[model samples]
Every structure is written in structure tokens, then in C-alpha cells.
Target: MEATGRLPAVRGIDAAAPFRWLGWAWRDLWTTPGPLLLYGLLISATSLALSWAIYRTNAAFWVLALTFGFVFVAPMLAMGPYEAGRRLDRGELPRVLDLLLVRKALRQDVAYLGLALLVIYFFWGRIAQIVYGLSTWQIYRTIPEFLTFALTTAEGQRMLLVGSGIGGIIAYGTFVLVAVSAPMLLDPRASVFAAVATSVRAVSRNPGPMLLWALVILALVMLSAATAFVALIVVFPWLGLASWRAYRELVAEAPEPAAARPLNPVATR
Candidate 1:
């Protein structure tokens, strides 16, 4: 915000901040239910379709990839919900069109962020395949068989341990980049670099609370996946809104544009 050279400074939140975000997100969701819930359903459907595609392949590795991959790709998918959160903040109800075809999300900086995450996603998938291949000569095709191997056998257990360790490092690094960047893109003032810079600062500044936040998101996503993503219709939106709150609270807002910005229906509020 200052001469485009210095980005906004992040404020450190207490460990309880993540928990409080849930309450705010829940309120925002119902306050603008029609659009946000519909948006969540859309994401849930996409998740189910993606999971089903991998299930059809009978490749347990991709299944595992897709499960953890949710954490990697979720922030990109949550852009619409971020807009919804912004709208709610301004006392405006988001419309279905706004949620579906988000104008702000279509810009170049977001595209860069999306591309970076996509690359990270594929890299994670490749690493997963490598781990699975190294774990055993025989590939486990069926989910049940894979489950037995993963849960009961020593080789399978070791594979999980090693893979999770690697994946956790990658996931946490991805989180540091995306913790606020994705939502910050909603503002015209934020370029991807500045957004990511601010995101990294916030998490590094408050690791304990941010780690708790990350774990909370993983737990919720796992629960939703357990239901074949039925719970995601609610949980996804809740998290998305919470993420917006995370951005708003973590970093101070940029100064308003000098000229009158384009009139947005939500901005009018």
C-alpha cells in the first residue's frame, strides 16, 4: 500500500483465532445461504467426480494423492466464497452469478497463483507415485487391498510414514504461500507476490495458531471426504469464509483506489 514497494504488515493472532473464525464463517454462510451453499454444492460435486474418476482407475496412489490434494487445491476453488465473504462484510448478499462467474478471480495475478498451485499439485502427485512404487513391486489396484496393506503390513506402514513426512513438508510450504494470498487476490490492490508475501509473514509470525488452523482444515476435509463429500457442501463454504476473515485480520487493508473504482453491486453496500 505504501508506494507499491512495501506490502502491508501482518498482525499476529492468538492460538484461538482459528477457532473463532469458524463462528464468523458460519454466520456469513447462513446470512448469504443461497449463493454460498450453492457454491459449496458445486465444489462438492466436482470433488465427487474427481474422486470417482480416480476410484475407477483402481490406482490407490492417485486416490491418496487426491485425498491430500484437496488441501492443495482448495484455496483456488474457494475464490468465489472469498468474494461472498467480502460481500457479507459490506452487508450485501451474494448472487448465484457472482459466485459462479467471479470477475475478480479471473485476473492475471490469480492465474499466476493458480498455475503455481497446479504445478505444486502435480509435483505432489508425482512424489506420491514415487513413494508407492518404492514401497512395493506389486501395485495395489483395489481400495480394500490398499487399505489392508496400508493399515496392516509393515511395508505399507513404512510407506505411509515416509510419504506423509514428505507430503507434510510440501503441504505446509503450500499453506504458507496460500494462507492469505488466494483471498487477498479479491482486492484489486493485491498482486500475487504481495499477497503471498503477506501470507508467509502471518504464518511465520504465528506458527502455533496457523498450524492449528491447518490441522483443523485437514480434519474437516477428511470428515467431508469420509461422507463422499456430502459434508463439504457446508464445510467448504465455512472454511472459505473463515479464510477471508483470516486474510482481513492478518493484514491491514490497502488504501482505496484514488479514482472512483468501477461500481460493483456488492461494493455499493
Candidate 2:
């Protein structure tokens, strides 16, 4: 679709809007489980593979880098769910291959926006490490030992507060950049700048509901991580579909083209 001359109006939704979107997302998932489940499984397997690959190196940085960096990649990960929701809206069944069909988006602005996010995520991980370094002098050799130190020490508590604060800032920034921009990128005609601006405006206009939505996402992601990413098999897809609905609601409809600039009055006369 081509970009309309004017940007659409972003709707102001209530706090309950996020829940409603989730309900719609859940319905989309069950309505077309086969493909979404397969996509989810693939993501789960990839995450496991990454964990396994990094664990062998015994490097905490690599592990943490990928773990936290997963957030940066999630918008891309959920592209399939976004498409599924679109299909459902059109009363069409979503296909499994649609998950891999992002090649079209990749050729356009999505890939560039994704790269920008990657840079931000890399810096976020670096900031997290700096926080850890400043807060602790202990050098633990193992995951369990490190966990114990963090849980049982004053330095660890301070580190948690500092790190979490910094992390939250980075996460919020990324959310504002990608929330609606990503879906807009799926449209071939939309430029990255325009998409990002639309997203910022949407969040600005609907701060309450958007913040609520972000909190909901954070809660679900934490739950999934706590379960060792297993819960993502469901939660991940659900969030994806819901995000698509969010974009649809937030971006305004395109304006009608100017009626062939009415023939010059004098010429018509």
C-alpha cells in the first residue's frame, strides 16, 4: 500500500484497551494454531540453540548479551503473528509459510529499522555490564555462584536497582520506536522515518494505554523467561497478534487523493 498524503490519527484508548487487544490476539492464535504453533516452536528452538551455543563459551557477557538482546529481535519475531492477525481480519486463514514471508518487508525499511534496534540493544547490554561492574567486586566463576552473590549481598541489590532502571529506560525507548513503526514497515510504501514518527505520536497521544500495554508485555516476557523461554510458545505469538491490532488502531486511515485538482476554472470555462 502507498503512503497517504497525510498521517492517520492515533486513537486514544483506555487502560482496558491492552486487555482487549490481548483477547483478540488469543482468539487469533487459536483460530489458526497450526502455523503459529510451528512458528513459536521454531523461535523456542532458536533461543535454546543460542543458549547452548553461548553456555559452552563460559562467558557471561555473551549469554547476557543474547538473553537481553532478544527483546530487540522480538518485533521481527512477531511479524508472523502480525500477518496472521491481518489475515484473520480479512476472514482468511493464515498459512505457516507466512511466518517466513518477511522477505518482502526485509527488502524495504524493516531491515534497516531492525539494524538500528540492534545497535541500541548492544549499547543497552554494555550499560548493563557497566552497572554490574560498578555494583560488585566479587568475581564468581559459575552461574549459581553469581546468582547467590547477587541475591545475598548488598552490592547485588544496588546493582539490581541501577541495572533495572537503566534497562527500563532502554526498553521504553525501543518500545516507543518500534511499537507501531514495525507494522508500518510491513507496508511497502511507508518510510522508516514516517513510521517512527507515527509510533512516537501514537504513544504520545495515548500514553496511559500504551504504558499499560508495555507493562503487560514486560510481565509476560518476564514470565516466559522465568520458565526458561518455554512459555513463549504461547505468549510470544499472542503478543505478536495483539501488537498488529495495536498498530491498526493507532495509525490513522489514509486520506482520499485530491480530486484530480479540479481543472483550472478559466480553462474549464
Candidate 3:
């Protein structure tokens, strides 16, 4: 459908669109199960090894800090699979390396990606500090005073409760925007503002499905982390493809006009 002057209003589609999109996603996975499995295993093993090393050194805090940094860079790796899926949808063959190369070509978008990460990091750090302070009140307080506070007060509990609520809102907002923006950035033709706005609107319009998707993504993310990152390779690919399919389904596609043909004297005669 062509853009009708105004941007399309968000509306419900056939209930079956999601199912159809999912079926296609599964078919794509089935065709490339080997690499996907191997990838997941490798990610799991690496995450586990790195985590074990960090824990042994009593550098859990450092590990947590590094995760803040990783959040910015890790999405770049998924760009390849994301692009590959987009191409697959368009009936174009895309190589594994194409995912990596595409990012290089879209250097400007990478800057936007970084800015998005910074926004996430700032909120995450604030939430972390609040929770950490509540957990470690004794370190800063005099021993006797700390004991008195803990024994007589509900201050820590209140801090934790408030922190959790704030953190949840930040998490939900971040998830909704980032989930779709990464793939939208891959297009390079679309503006970052448009991509993010569309993503937010998409989630708002279909809260039920989007929430289900968010939960599923969270589960997979936790599973990957629990397995030490090996699960990420498979989970990442699956999720990446699923995400691309979701975008394709939820966002309105702009219609293109028919291409003009070259004029030929023989045809005219």
C-alpha cells in the first residue's frame, strides 16, 4: 500500500500474520540448524569461561561494569544475522560476513547505536547505584551507626522497592525501543528518529504480543547468561530472525511505484 499523504495509523492486521511470520522464521532456522547450534554453543562456552575467570578473581563488580560496556557492542554482532534475514525475506542470498560488513557501511548509524547504548547505560548505572548503596550501607556508615540503622529502620527496604520500580520502567522502555531499532538501522535509508518512533509505536499498538515477545527474549537472554554465553549464538540468531520478522509484520511497508522501461525503436515501430 502507498503512503496516503499521512503516515499510516497503527491498526490490527489479520490475526494470522504473526503465525505466518513465525512459520517462515522456523523454516529459515531449519535450513541452517548446524551453524546456529555451533554458534550458540560457542557463545555459551565463552560466556561461562569468562564469568568463571572473573568470579575466581573476586571481580564480580568489574564483570558487571564490563557488561555495561558490552551492551553497547554486542548488538553490532547481531547486525549480520539481522541483515541476512532481511535479505532472505527479499529473496536475496546474503552471506554470513554480510552481517558484519553492513555495519561498516552504515557508520553513521553506529554512532546512533552508541548514543542509544549511552542512554541505556546511564539509566542502568543510576539504578545499579541505588541498589548497590542500599545493599552496602554498612561500608560507608560507622559500624555502630550502621548496626543501629539496620536494626531500627526500613530505609534499605524502601530504597530497594523504589529502585526496582524505576529499574523496571527503564528496562521496559529500553527493550521496546532497542528491539526494533537495531534492525531498522540496518536499512540505512531510514532515519534513527523514525526507526525509534516506529518501534515505540509498534510496541504501544500491540502491547500483548510485544510483552510476550519481551518475556520470551528475557528468558532466552537469561538462559544464555546462565549457560555462560554459549546459548547466545543459537538464541541470538533465533531471536534476531524473529525480531526481523516481527518488524516486517508490525511496521507498514512503503509502497514503490512501477519502474519505467527503456524505450526501444523496434518496439515502437
Q: What C-alpha lDDT values do all the predictions have?
A: 0.84, 0.75, 0.58
The candidate scoring highest on TM-score is: 1
Model 1 steric clash pairs: none
By lDDT rank, best first, the candidates go: 1, 2, 3
Q: Write the per-residue lDDT of candidate 2 for residues 28-111, one digit (tens) a residue.
A: 789889999888877877887787776766755456546766777788778888777666665667788877685547665777
67-141 per-residue lDDT for model 1 (tens digits): 887899899999888888777666567899988888989899999999999999999988988998889898788
Q: List runs of model 1 lying over 4 Å from the truth.
A: 254-269
Which candidate tops lDDT? 1
Error of 3 at 214 (Å): 1.0
Q: Candidates 1 and 2: which is better by lDDT?
A: 1
How many residue pairs clash per model?
0, 1, 9
RMSD of 2: 8.0
Instruction: Please provide, for model 3 over 44-163, each residue's C-alpha lDDT reduced to its tens digit, 9 standing for 90 to 100.
Output: 576667766766675554355344334434454566666656666655555545654675336676568667777776767766666757665444223344335434668745654675
Q: What is the TM-score of each candidate against the true structure?
A: 0.92, 0.88, 0.70
Could you tell which candidate, 1 or 2, scores higher by TM-score? 1
Deviation of model 3 at 129, angstroms = 3.1
Better of 2 and 3 by TM-score: 2
Please state the error at residue 122 of candidate 3 in Å: 4.7
